[model samples]
Target chain A: MSRTLFFTSLLYRSTTEHKRAIAEFCSNVKMCRLTEQVVFSDPYKISQYNRWTAPYLDEDAEAVRQDNDLKLEIAELKAKFCERAQALLHGDLHTSSVMVTRDSTRVIDPEFAFYGPMGFDIGAFLANLILAFFAQNGHSNGEDDRKAFKRYICQTIEETWSLFEQKFIALWNEHRDGSGEAYLPGIYNNPKVLQLAQKKYMADLFHDSLGFGAAKMIRRIVGVAHVEDFESISDPGKRAACERKALDFAKLLLKNRRSFVQIGGVVRAMRQVEE
Target chain B: MSRTLFFTSLLYRSTTEHKRAIAEFCSNVKMCRLTEQVVFSDPYKISQYNRWTAPYLDEDAEAVRQDNDLKLEIAELKAKFCERAQALLHGDLHTSSVMVTRDSTRVIDPEFAFYGPMGFDIGAFLANLILAFFAQNGHSNGEDDRKAFKRYICQTIEETWSLFEQKFIALWNEHRDGSGEAYLPGIYNNPKVLQLAQKKYMADLFHDSLGFGAAKMIRRIVGVAHVEDFESISDPGKRAACERKALDFAKLLLKNRRSFVQIGGVVRAMRQVEE
Candidate 1:
């Protein structure tokens, strides 16, 4: 993201050596210990921390606990989350991690930073925006109805993925000759072959992002944590309504991520999700 | 696996509480630093250590170095080998690591042990057997002449996977109620759903084993290390023939591993790969 680059620019200049300083920083084990339970384990199984509107989502929660296929998929994702060290990721890149002003952008609160899939960061931000979209119903008022805000959040999600794809391909083209370990310039020098490889890589990243993003949304609704979008709703019943939609959407995304090839498809699906 | 049980039995008897000891072991970094060149990097690029039946297979080796798709596939496999920690793998599980006595079977030389894909071990063993199969053409004499020996090696490869599948599924069926974190008894308790889950897991494991096995085979023939299968042949031209067939077979297997649904398919392919 441009914001990440802006922040990286500041840090890049501050460093004594401009060398791409690659170090395997030890993950905060306590945080991993906690997240492993909340994100991967607890939500699928019954746990004390899990909560929803009583009587309203009791059966829904029970349904989740009993879903065999869902649990099986989650098991695979959990193993990937715990085991795969794909890249150095911004572990907690929710909308809260970013700030945007007229002329400035910044990323903050990366204390949860560790090696992970790039999608973890992308998914966190997109999933949170989606939460805002769903919660718009609860946030509506007489004068400042959030119908427009809901549309804006969807727009942001759509733009984020489209621009990311265009820019990512452009950057790969620019650096096709550089010393990138994933794709060698000498081997992938042909335009046609390179394009195919890029398509596959980006699709993989998209799926990962969707899966991680769904996990993030699920945790916010039912696990140890709750997001501000749903938390801010005054009426518990209304809050649960918004949270339930988000949870349903998250579960669908986590299970059916590969079915999506385009971000617009996901955005359309987000719009179609019943309130 | 028996050796693992033997070790686990020793450790289990030592303590009552066997913990889920999950640590992202700082991969034997030195070992990785060494293998990256020999297995992944040096063979693709340039290195003094690389040699074949030079002047005989010189063009074949050059073709490998110049092949774009081959390098692309290698890059992916290399990344997976370096990054994905699917399980606690025997890092260097060539035929050399396995030992067989009259009444005792043991796996030795685990100095390079760390967490990795189960396929790495399976692939190593299978690839080495294939190598032995290819080397049969060179190992001929007036004696046994390896006709039955070749059949025996292929049989071993087939039984290794078939027996592994049978025993693995049976164990899963028996311990479907046990405290395995990968699949919970509460959710995947039923037979139909459990069978479906087992099928998917085994298929994935088979593909990984094939891919990793192919990588191991390629590295042995074309990289710095030469297997005794080819090295034992006194005739350089004859050795080149054996090595080339092995290398060609490895390439096909690595790129098209997913097409194989069963080990018998691979064995049949092995039988087809002529001397």
Candidate 2:
């Protein structure tokens, strides 16, 4: 008997609370075969589904309508991307919502967790981490130390995506109710076929990841909740410059999200940013 | 027989390597009596005066112009505002640069530390902490814990600013050099006049502090180094919404900075912001 528990809170909950809730939730999940709703569709439930929430309706009715329209378009695109990609989706994947304790890796906050486009979760998680990494300078000194921290983050991005893909594929192969649908049976199991398929999937994921990553990065730097790293820098000019760089990086990545065919390309693009 | 050290760092000497060299540099400042060239000049040379630096320019063109422009502006502003305010400055004041060890509370990162706006440092430090308080939600959680954390932050802001002002005024009263034409001897020091003067000075400082405080708050949320508090939020929409509120609060404060002639106004504005 497996019980599947749903994670409730994300923003207000601390890491320890997050961990505890996840453990309990997982225990419940193991006991029940409940299909947790990761993404909320009901307009009334939008607040419950997202971390950084805003009322769906803004002060201006027209502006609110426009924003909603934009969201709908994005959703349509997301659905399209998922359909085209035809891959195992983690549904809602982002690091803050994820919890692990030694032996088993369990996802706690699954308000939006689902199976659709695996790239969405992978991309969102990596993008957010990168944003945090660039902002780390505001909080600490020691250039060498900052560098070490960045290296750790970059490695995590690569490793997490790599491991997730490995696990997802393994799960799919083992549990796949073979239907000979759009995907080839066991093509991922073949060395040459698997390599080609992996490359293509990675390319698609990288592109989507870059787009969402840019959006997340841009919104944070200029949108709201500006990082403390720049806050610690007393010079307003220097702070402004750092912010400009982050925004620039975001715009570049978002605009070229689809053009990225490999993970190396994305890295190279990010590296080219002067800041 | 007595050695007095100013915690402020000289502008030029401040670098990544020299981040930890301020304590040593203070000793050099006292021993060398480097004030003539380092403290007051048409253009001060801090980094160049140190033996470790290589010659980059025969003269820093921008610094010379900046010094001339800033000096004139300060002198004019001082003469105007002096009627209602005190003259003392803390060039660079913010958290992460300030260190506290047991009984000692001294500012460390003061490369830009100078005397201009007395409230700038105080306001900046408080603003940084406030941002951090909100950001803590990204990692930790407990309903009561969050409530307690917020209360502690609010108290810290109130107390720290109050204490800083009291200490600053006390220092000013003790060390006021009577050489300046602005000082009319007993005209200001007379007990009856002194009370009125203190009231006015406090009012002006409080107003200026609010403006700077608002700027620090707004920029951190909308500027460069974005906070992690919202990132910790698993729900994307909610996180974004909360951040929007923070930004909105910052913008309001900045726009209404000039209106903050009374400290009560500043406090009221902050309290008015709905989160």
Candidate 3:
């Protein structure tokens, strides 16, 4: 799912001129402020636009508001989302923004597009996938239970992150000697040092992705907007159950993302959450 | 020294529109790239423009190039300098950029002004002061030794950071209910949460100031441009000794800035480096 977004990010070379041009272009969009308002702030506060399975999840939503630790973590993530211009991101890369037709996939609706942390795009896509994974239970019937489909979603989530990491490192190695400004070739050219740099970069990116993915999940469940995965479930009780599980996992992820070092661990934790 | 810069930053309320306008203005400056090159990149690598007191400190210059850990920390700082756009900065806030008189003080030479981490401006001014403190020995004589002057400089350094923190937080508290985008009153209105948020914000800024201050100090010693503090010393040995002391302190601060929690501790550390 993130392949196209990552490829689009790689299209521009990381020369000084390229970075300045991209940053200039991104500055005009005002997407950073928009994302901070919608994704990070509104959901955590008492906003009129916020909605949920009201009677069922009222306390849950209030818990999100009152979670001081959660609010603090979200503030830090919001700061990063606003401050770090790591790359060009598809500012709203949810499942609806993507169209998959077996052989090819196309991402659309870039009105929110701007320069931001790459993890936002990656995390957005993955969060939607996790939402679908959790909602599979709500859609399940007697004969066609979605246990297998849930596993498939989990696998897709893991593969998306692992593949993105592999390809990103490959691209970095290919351009290690280029005019990229992030890590100069002269300083990081030593193979051992290069390895260390890559490890640190990927680790940081992983944590960022988890933090963003969880925030995206929390916002969807409680903020003004929501996803069809849970909405499509006719039964509100079942839908709330699925959302509560997802919300629990997201709260945990947002608070303790750094403790998670790999995609597999996240998947495992997702499966362990009670529905 | 930073009074004007901080005041200028506070002039614009952090409304969404105001932030967008400032960010747009800053994006066009390209000062971020220039600082990255001169302050963070060029000195650590082999560059024709890089020079020092040559044979007098040839080994020390080479040691800077050989320190892998230093290179790694610098890369992180450079990334922050490039990526984080926290506030408007007088991009080149060194000593020469200011003009002071008995009645009033004026800041000039803002060719490098842009939206950047506030610490860059704060650190540049403080780092220049530190360099002056280290260079006092070279200018000392029997009739007028600079020991008392050095102590005065140390007090000034401590007061500069402490006062900045006090004033900045005062501004934040005064405008807590304003429409600022960084920390909304709805979410952070509680006294306890507000205190936590302020503590976190100031602590991060303090560390950033130290890191940037150290980087600025380092570039003056080994990068293309040398500072008048060390450059004016007539004796090569004396100049190298002062430069070496400043360089040693800077390297330590750069690598271990987070371990320092207070400005007083940093002032003490600056005094401990052997001259």
Q: What is the lDDT of residue A93 in candidate 3?
A: 88
Candidate 2 ranges beyond 4 A from true positions: A1-275, B1-90, B136-142, B175-181, B227-236, B258-271
Q: Is the docking of candidate 3 incorrect, acceptable, medium or high quality?
A: acceptable
Pitting candidate 2 against candidate 3, the one with the higher TM-score is 3
Q: Indicate the worst ten consecutive residues by lDDT in candidate 1 chain A.
A: A10-19
Instruction: Give the Cα lDDT of each candidate.
Output: 0.71, 0.42, 0.80
DockQ of each: 0.30, 0.01, 0.46
Q: Give the clashing pairs for model 3.
A: none
In terms of lDDT, the best-performing candidate is 3
lDDT of 1 by residue, B1-275 (tens): 52342232211221111112213344355665466567766666666888778898778877877776777677667656655555556677788887889998787877666545567777888899999998888777846678999999999999988987787676666656654555655556567767777787889889988988888888887788978878989988778888888888998998899999999999999878853
- Candidates sorted by lDDT, descending order? 3, 1, 2
Off by over 4 Å in 3: A1-34, A141-144, B1-15, B22-31, B142-144
lDDT by residue for model 2 (A37-145), tens: 1221111122232222123212222222123322332333332232221232344455655687888777765553322333455666776666655655544464556
* Residue lDDT tens for model 2, B28-140: 22211222122222121233332210132222323322333223222222211111111223334567666889988776644543223455556666666666555544444
Q: Pick the candidate with the highest DockQ.
A: 3
* Better structure of 1 and 3 per TM-score: 3
| Per-model TM-score on C-alpha atoms | 0.84, 0.33, 0.93
